[model samples]
Target: MRTFEYRLRPTKAQEQALMRTLLASRKMYNACLEDLITHYKETGKYLHLYEQDKHHGKEAHPDLPAVLVDTTLKRLHRSFTNFFRGLKEGRKIGFPRFKGATAWNTIQFRDAANCLDNGRFKAPLQCGGRMRVIVHRPLEGTFKFARIVLRPSGWYLQCVCETPPHPLLKKENAVGLDMGIRYLVADSNGHIIDNPKHARKTAKRLAHAQRNLARCKKGSHRRKKAKKKVARLHEHIANQRKDTLHKASRSYVDGYQTIAVEDLQVSNMVRNHCLAFVIADASWGMFRQYLEAKAESAGRQVIAVRPHYTSQTCSQCGESVEKSLSVRTHVCPFCGYIADRDENAARNILQRGLQVLARTGPSSSRREGPEQSGESPSVLKREAAGL
Candidate 1:
């Protein structure tokens, strides 16, 4: 499934209806969350989705469409599912919270069949009229659902569609990636993508907007305008980051047949006080996500190798060479080999990924610890003691 988003040109009445629908969905979400908390506290058991739906009955929301209401309830249920799944996987995750009006900005329609499409689409709501859509590109396959998202700039319509899979392209080139704070990505071939630092670059503008917002009185028109300015700056920064990542990842996927990258635990990595902000700004997680998605569609392979010792171990000699973060160049003590630290790490990652592919084949290859599947017992023991 793929999603295509377009800017919506809603009429004044349509805009009001959309806002009302979003507000109604937020209230419903809060109500369901409250029900769960009350039920859990009173009975010491969670209120499941179906049970909650029964309580809501067959009554339709005043201004919201039935499809929107149902979809919102289902989304709330999915949040619980994810929260519980995270707990089961020994991950620290917060429980679902009641959403305020500001928090809930999206309203979805589960069924695309109900929507009437001509030049514009008519949504199912009492006040919802036909809204003009800007289709920048043609949508493929069957439309599964639609979601209306309210952003700082304007409203957007996101259409989810099920697309047919095409045959994968065959290629001979394989590359590895090393993500860093200074550079966005360093490939095995020594190509480095400089980090754009979108947020840092726009820091002054954001700071000024924030200061303006702080000076304005709460609940005043000036405050609302100031808040919008701050939000728009943030949105711009996010868009810039996303666009840069997409281009970088797309280039790799298009050029390489096989791609190797570190299986970084970004959530855990962010706990380090010194590098947390830098790591978050790099957006390594999103880059990996984009790479994987592109690789999947292109019939390429992405190998997530163990990150441990990749930077410390010499790619030329396969010997451990201790280094600190400040050391940009890698110098191997055993073989007198030298290279950029990130480049060396990328080479090691590529070697490890190739070995993994040879052992398990590309189809079965996945993220795993070297000790669990590769590396002899003696090697593991030696590495444990830094022998």
Candidate 2:
């Protein structure tokens, strides 16, 4: 399934209706959460969705439709489920919490049949009622569901649709990418894409807006206006960052049949306070996500290999050469080879990815039979490990 998002233009009355529905949904979410906590505290046992529904199944929220209520409750239940899963996986995750009025901004409609009529939005008409939508591109495939999202800029609709893969003919069959804050992407092909620091560019504007917001009296009209301005600035930066990532990922998918990249633990990487802000602005994670998603629809492959020593090991000599993060170039003593640090890393990533593909993926022909090969990869691995 793929998602397509479009701009929504709702009238003032419709906008009020949308706000009211969102508020109602938030209230319902909070009420359900309170009940769960109360029940758990009293019984010392947790209540799942069904049990909670049984307890308050008869309650009616006029503004919140039945479909909307189910979606909201399921979302709350899913949050708890995720929290438990995170605990089991030893991840840092907090328990489910109540949603504030501003926090809850999405309403999903489960029954999504004929969501569009003559290229106009039609789903969940009771709330916003057939609003004007820009269908910039033709949507292909069966409609699944519609998600209404309220952003600082305006309202938007996300349509999830089931579509078959549209494969493109491959050229430049494989390449690896080294992602970094300085350069967004450096490929094994020696191509480099500079990182566009959207947040940094707009930092001054954001700071000024935040200062204005802080000076405004709390709950005053000026405060609200200032807050919205800050939010819009933030949204603009996010959109700019997302746009760059999408274009870069799309180019990679279109140019390469197989894309290899480091399986970076971004959560761990962000712990370094000095580089955290820059790293977040770089958005390496979003780039990978876009690459994988686009590759899937295009019938291409994405290989994520371990990022342990790609930067330290020599791509030409296969020898370990440790260097500080400050080093911008790689010079191998053993092989007398020299190259850009990120390019060497990209080469190493591609080589490692090909090795992985040989071992596991059926698409690769790198693995030869025992009768045809001189030695197996396991023999070399064992020799390298001195085992």
Candidate 3:
């Protein structure tokens, strides 16, 4: 299934209705949580969603759509399921907390027919009518479901549809990627994609807005306005980062038949206090996810190679050279090879990926060292140069 999201332009009345829907949904969720806790504690048994949903019409706002209530109950059930699943797996789990009025951002319609039709989208309470949807592209396949989400910027509609995959493209080029905070990505071809550092770039504006928010009196109109300003800045940063990622991933998928990247555990890496913020801002994991998803659609390969020693090992000669994080260049004394540290890692990643493909017959996605290829250093250089 593929999903599409479009910004929604709603009338002032429609906006009010959407806001009320969100508030009602949040209230119902908190009530359901309370009921579940009380039921379980009293009876020593689970209170399922069906039982909670049965009392919806009597307890919930009479005007609220049934779909909204059903979806909210389903969400509560899923949250509980995840909480138990995490506990069972020995992971730290927090009990679900009550959602604040402003915290609830999304309300989904389980049935597509309720909200969407040809050139028209309507909601309950006589608030909605024909909307001016900016159809950036044609939406394909059967619509499955639609959701109304409120962001710091504005409201949007996300629709999920079942789409048949296109025939795979015919391409033979492959490359390796090394992700870094300094540069967004370094490829095997010695090309460096600069990191935009969207959050860092917009830090001053965000800080100013946050400071204004702090100075405003709580529950005052000024504070609400200030809060929205802060949210807008955050939304801007997110949009900028997402745009950059989409462009970079599109290039990789369109240019290469196969792409290899280091299997870096970003979750573990973030534990280091010094670089935690930068690492999170870099969004290396998000980039890799986009790569894999796009590659799948383009009929390409995305391989994850073991990250160990990729930075220290010589790409020209099969020898290890120990270097600290401070070292920006790989100076291999054994073969007199000198290159940017990340570029060297990228080359090694490419060679290792090729070795994996040769051994596993181009279908392997697992991390395993197989026999090295017969290609020489000159051949790799030529390939990188597009010779």
Candidate 4:
């Protein structure tokens, strides 16, 4: 399923109704949590999820839509499931906490075939009228469900639809992408996109707004306004980064039939204090997410090869050559191969991806390694796959 977002323009009364809906949903969620704890502790048994909805749902808070109440209960159920799973697996777990006014800012609606039609939302309130919606681009496929989210800027409606695939013509083009700090992407095709460093560019303004927020008295109007200002600045940076990544991922999906990229261990990489700031700014994980989603829709393939010695091995003859981060140029002492460091890595990634395809075709999505072993993700794959 694909999702489309639109801006909602509600009249004063309609806006008030929406706010009430949001508040009721939040309260309903918290009430469900309280009941879950009480029921679990009292009888050590799981309560019927929908049965409790009769007490805390529309019967108790009639202002909220029934669909909204149902969705809220499901959210609580999912959280409890995850919490229990974490405990079973011996992982860190935190019990779901009650959300405050600011934290609870979304209300979801289902069975809304009429909720978004002809660029208008049929008002959910008893007062019947249509709410203006800015449909910047026409939505595709059948409307499934929608969620109205409150942000620092304004209210937004996220509409999920069952979109059909729009596949491109078959082609044989393939490229490998090496993610880096200096450049956001370096491809096997010898192309590069520079990292814009969105957060670093707006650092001064963010710091100033944060300072103002800290100086204001607690729970004062000025402090709230300052907090919003800081939030807007952050939102701006995020929007910029998202836009760039979308464009880059779209360009690749349109041009290449197959895309290869290293399965980077970003969580492990960020442990170094010196490079943490820049690495977070790169947002490699976000880029990969966009790549995979777009690729799936476009009927293209994306292969994630292990990233062990891609930068150290010679792409030409597969000779292992040790190198440090300071070395920007890769000089292969064995094969006399010479290329830019990231470019060589990209080439190596492409080679590994092809080998994987030869072994298992283009349908493998698991990380290129065994489930558990005393080996790194890369070396294990290489030794097992004989690559």
Compared with the true structure, all predictions reach lDDT values of 0.78, 0.78, 0.75, 0.77
Ranking 1 against 2 by TM-score, winner: 1
Model 1, C-alpha of 206: deviation from truth (Å): 2.2
Whole-model lDDT, model 2: 0.78
What lDDT does model 4 reach?
0.77
Error of 2 at 93 (Å): 3.1
lDDT of 2 by residue, 1-387 (tens): 888898888889888888888888889889999888998999998898887776544257666667787888889999999999989987767999888776889988886752766767775655867777888887779888888899999999898999988888866578989886567789998899886766566767888998899999988999989999999998888787898889999998999888888776554432333333444434867888888888888878888777667888999989999886667799999999899989998999999888877788735222222232222112112222331
Task: Output the better candidate (2/3) by TM-score.
Answer: 2
lDDT of 1 at 230: 93
Task: Output the TM-score of candidate 1.
Answer: 0.89
Instruction: Kindly report which residue stretches of model 2 are placed more than 4 angstroms away from their true locations once superposed.
Output: 55-59, 123-126, 197-200, 214-220, 271-282, 363-387
Instruction: Please provide, for model 1 over 15-132, each residue's C-alpha lDDT reduced to its tens digit, 9 standing for 90 to 100.
Output: 9888887787898888888888889999999888787787665464656666766787899989999899989987777799888767888877778754437647667755376788
Candidate 4 segments exceeding 4 Å error: 83-95, 126-129, 197-200, 265-282, 364-367, 370-387
RMSD of 2: 7.3
Question: How many backbone overlaps does candidate 3 show?
Answer: 0
Model 3: lDDT to the true structure: 0.75
Off by over 4 Å in 3: 57-61, 89-94, 126-132, 197-200, 211-222, 268-282, 364-387
Question: lDDT by residue for model 3 over 1-387, one digit each (tens)?
Answer: 788887788878778878877887788899899999999999999898787777887345575677777888899999899899979975556788899866789977787665555555655553354554555666788888888888987888788888875636678888999876567789989999886665566767888988999999989999999998988987887777788888998898889988898766554432333332443434677888888877776678888776767887999997998886667899999999999998998999999888878878765245555332222223222222331
* Full ranking by TM-score: 1, 2, 4, 3
Candidate achieving the largest TM-score: 1
Model 1, residue 228: distance off in Å is: 1.2
